[model samples]
Target chain A: MIVADKKPIEEIIESVKEFKKILILGCNECVTVCEAGGKKEVGILASALRMFFLNQGKDVKIDEQTLERQCDHEYLEEIRDVVDQYEAILSLACGVGVQFTAEKYHSTPILPGVNTCFLGATEQRGLWTERCQACGSCILAFTGGICPVSRCAKRLLNGPCGGSSKGKCEISKDVDCAWQLIIDRLKALGKLDEYEKVQPIKNWSTDRAGGPRRVVREDVAL
Target chain B: MLAEMEPPKGVDISVMMENASRVKGEIDAFVVPEMSNAVMRMSALGGALLLQKNGMDTVMQVCCRDRNRLALQADLLAAGASGVKHIMVVTGEDPGFGDHHQAKAVYDLTLLELLDAIEKMENGHDMSGIDLCGSPQFLVGSTVNAGLSAQALESELSEMNQKIKSGVDFFITPPLFDIASIKPFLSCVDLSKTPIIPTVLLLKSLGMARYMARNVKHVHIPDELVRRIQNAPDKARECVNIAAETVHAIKEHGFSGVCISTIGWEDKVPDILKNIS
Candidate 1:
């Protein structure tokens, strides 16, 4: 799922400083799953902001609302009635949701309350790590289920770089050498013979390097 | 000058002291490796500061894979404040190769970008065009690969040129088993502008040589070198002899000096140096 982190309270306060009335919007999708921009987080952020404004002696009125998902137009339309009650919106959704919400309410400014990090998975309840770079083509199968595109620091397709020492990356102990993981997984699976296969230069046109991408499904197109 | 010390895992002052004292009279400067093995230890910058406090000239190894532009600048400023003037800038190994399997890497700047940033700071400004309170002066260095396939050779040579253009004062090659292998690479370089420091690793055993040959990238371990170590009756003496010979060969090729990595055999450094002088 797409993972995000909440922006610091101070930065959030600064972003909405000019607004007297504000709406703290939340998404019940990926943000909720990752515990970043969920309804609970929305309340926590709203309370923090309210307290901050109270301490500052500012007459700021903040409202809270969470949608099932902010990416869809149908869920966004629910805010059409009460949308005009705020000067700005603090969207606790991914970048996609914030932009979609902005498009939905043309007049009101939608401020991103979270920093959209990457396409990742939650290893534990609180630890989320990147899993994919959304490169158009996938090579997880060849790489023994490890995505070098997302994991390898240099993203070298052939193998681990010279810097791999004691199975750790040169960067930090917190990071696992993706190629090491790939080699280990491949070794465990008895597919070590495939290690010699050199991956050719990737077709990056399918990746973001080409440009902003679009997908079309003619069969489902209305 | 060969000061080789790996970055410590925690703030172990005793180990730092041992490391500092061991190379006291042997090397002119000690190199504090960046977060090697993917574990967060005392940072190279922090380690350099500690060594400098102990009265040793330290070369802080800075990698581009970790910090962004702002953090890099701030750290460089801090290094200058701490009186560390020598730095070896590297396009560090990826974080994915480290212990932290889930850490986010910030490769906001490339090696060229980093060297350029330092150069700009030396001229009295930050990357954002803000005037600096004080300028940091550094005798900057960079790492280069020794043995290379025809493909990597060209690209790496081009990169070395770009680094020199960005104001790198010196270049250090990876731990080389055979100095002759780098002759092709050296021929391509304009040595007058950037002096090359060839590094030699003291091979402890055949297993060590083979392991390095297979796992360590860019290191060239010729078949004969491995065979000699494997078949040698006195492996320890042979290791020192080979290292000493490699150092001699590098100097014979008209290079200034060589960087020796004992690889935990710090005691053997004096032996290797004995044969060299």
Candidate 2:
């Protein structure tokens, strides 16, 4: 899952003020799963703006569409011909989808209506919280797959911080201590000895600081 | 009763952000925001917001079918923060007819919780303990279908009274075909003293009348209404005509005003309002 919060209606309407024809676009990928840039939210924003524009005596031709995935070129191509008809596009997808849509269409202006927060999971109905940092490192086998960089407040590398009390973080009492989780996992795996090894400083350059990392499998690609 | 909220000074229809700014003295706002899922499902919530913004002395709706508790509370708080005057509480429809069939529906806070939440909201706290920078005041309303008669009349009266205790300042009755369905309901209330607005339902299509009657229980659709609509060349168009007459009937019955419920034919609301005047 992912996390996203909707932008205010006034700001959204202001962005598409010039477009007499607008297509409220939604994404069915990560955005829809996270409840950020989904079809339902698209309707919400479109209706809000339509009312706002109509009240101001401005004419607006508002239509809504949700694609399988906006980030993918193939999915966006479905609307290639139709998009040319609209004056502007209001994308409810994440930063990735919005960028993709903008890249695909040269003539139309694409505006984002959601603030994409993070790659996360559905904690409950209508609630999405962060889970993955996409840091290009997987210590899941060693640290129980709970990335401390994303879950831990301080990103402590070793055992629990002194701030840990009752397995909860000092920053927020409701939050669980990530390092404490890592320690418990190490114990269960009989790798408590790894804790005594005195960990070296993290090499982020090898992870993602270098940027745009890719993976390849000869068999799969072939 | 909500008509009193506007300051008697002058007109102030410009929208204020979720801030301290408010529209001063404007009655009868035209709250008709565009409907969600124009491909299928339509809602009056948008209209409610638009009308409130334009200073129509609006009565907005808090539907049960849309958002869960979090979203509902946020929208309600936002509505109040935006200076919405009145709200008509309703149980919204499912999303099958719309684009979002898989989209979840939340009824976490029953009508009671919603009412309680709104009342709590008046004190500056949302259900989540987030305080509003400023207080929000709105006249709460509840929906009642006066057509049901299987239940005892006393039980029906008690239900209406219960919602009243739950913070509903006004009540909007659902649409009815013959006076029989509403007559029993009227006998239960002393409308001479009460301000509860009696709104009748308008059948927009023969398919719609049959659709509603088939799906909803105890909702009385007049036989003649069904027959007349069945005979019409353009049943969908005739629905608007029947709906308009229902509004006129509601007005003739000495009710303060009618809440035109144009479920499938959402566009017919403005026409009904026009005919009502």
Best by DockQ: 1
> Residues A1-222, candidate 1, lDDT per residue (tens digit)?
999998988899889988899999999999999998999999999899999889989999999999999999899999999999999999999999999999888999999999999999989888999999998889988999999899989888999888988888888878999999999999999998778998877765567644467999999999
Compose the digit string of candidate 2's lDDT tens values, residues B1-277: 1221111112342322111123223124332322233223234444445455654556666766666788777777677766677776766554444554444454567787788788878888888778867767887777676766647656767877888888888776655666666677787777766566654566656777888777766577767788888998987667767766766676677765555544334344455544543
Q: Give candidate 2's error at residue A116 in angstroms.
A: 38
Q: Pick the candidate with the highest lDDT.
A: 1
Error of 2 at A52 (Å): 67
Q: Worst ten-residue run, lDDT, model 2 chain A?
A: A203-212
After superposition, the stretches of candidate 2 with alpha carbons farther than 4 Å from their true spots are: A1-222, B1-47, B55-57, B64-74, B91-101, B123-133, B152-154, B234-237, B264-266, B269-277
Q: Evaluate all candidate structures by whole-model CA lDDT and list the values in order.
A: 0.85, 0.68
lDDT of 2 by residue, A1-222 (tens): 557778887788778888899999999877777777888888887788888888999988999999998889899999988998898999999888889999999889999988888878888887777787776655565566667878888766666678989999999988989988777877888887766665545545334433356788898985
DockQ for every prediction shown: 0.03, 0.01
Interface C-alpha root-mean-square deviation, candidates in order: 10.0, 19.4
Query: What docking class should model 2 receive?
Result: incorrect
Predicted complex 1: DockQ: 0.03
